[model samples]
Target: MRKIKAQLFISLDGVVEAPDQWHFPYFNDEMGAAVDATLGQADTLLLGRRTYDSFAGAWPGREAAGGEDAPFAKVLGDARKIVVSNRRLDFTWRNSEQADGGPAEAAAALRAEPDTGAPVWISGSVSVVRHLLAAGLLDELNLLVHPIAVRKGMRLFEEADASVPLELLSCETFRTGVLNLFYAPAAGPGAGTYEDAKTHLPQH
Candidate 1:
């Protein structure tokens, strides 16, 4: 089976949108290596529409530009990309295709196919991640939690989203103070309710 992994760069307060405004300052070699390692495990990328458009505008010709960022740009440019969106998009990138149905349906079909021994990575797609997580199709979620509190952007999980219990797989802290958190879906509703934990509380 092809493993599905979702990765995001999120702030301490849970903001995930527009990372460019505050993200690069904490970037370092360690973060680069962590990202590289994640990409190295996958040949296919699952992207949300906005991210796809941004990448479509950003990565196409960087390889030939021969800069320090060329190698990573090349990797993204050549990887098989699947965009999840109902809206029509102009796919100008190579090896890119729009998903046939909803996120869950698309993921189910992908996983049901012959195991290619390669993982499908969900990159910068918050909506896709949420959908897949809700559908129980995501095998793993990797979050690089930055220490800053970005007071204004869409968070990874919002007030309208349902509760999800996650199992922590591993966690590492980079020198730049970024937290690399890997999590898998837990089976049940979670530890329990406040009422259930009442026994552990001290008497007033």
Candidate 2:
């Protein structure tokens, strides 16, 4: 079955919103390469309605401009896009369609399909990522953690959500202070460690 790889550009303080405003300032060749490494293998995209609308609106025009971004624009424009939305979605973008159901159902169905070795990518779709992460359906999570702390903004996980333990796959720090962290849900529990003791304390 094809795996799901979710990518997010997040701040040290866990903000995931409006990456366009704060993201580009720190972007460099290193960061660009890291992004490309993920985008390169993917033939399909899993997007939230907002993200789908944004990409459909901008990328086609960018592709036509024949500029530096045109290559990536063309990549996105040509790839299959699966959009998740509750409301009616009359997509104008080519090869776009609504997901089968909610995030988990849609992702589960996608994963059940015959493996062609291509990945389904999640791009700037926090809600969909959260649902999949909570449901234990996400295969890999790639976070480009920036150094800055944007104290206030939308976050991927809220305080109300329970903790999800992850096993780190790889960690690389770029020259620009960005950290490319790759993680997957842990296979199983490990022997209790010192940190586990803290949770045993009686409630106050």
Against the true structure, what is each candidate's TM-score? 0.92, 0.91
Off by over 4 Å in 1: 189-204
Q: In candidate 1, which residue pairs get closer than 3 Å at backbone N, Cα or C atoms, i.e. clash?
A: none
Candidate with best TM-score? 1
- lDDT of candidate 2 over 94-154, digit per residue (tens): 7888998899998998898888778889988999999998999999999999999988899
Q: What's the true lDDT of residue 45 in model 1?
A: 91
Clashing pairs in 2: none
Local accuracy by lDDT, each model: 0.89, 0.89
Off by over 4 Å in 2: 187-204
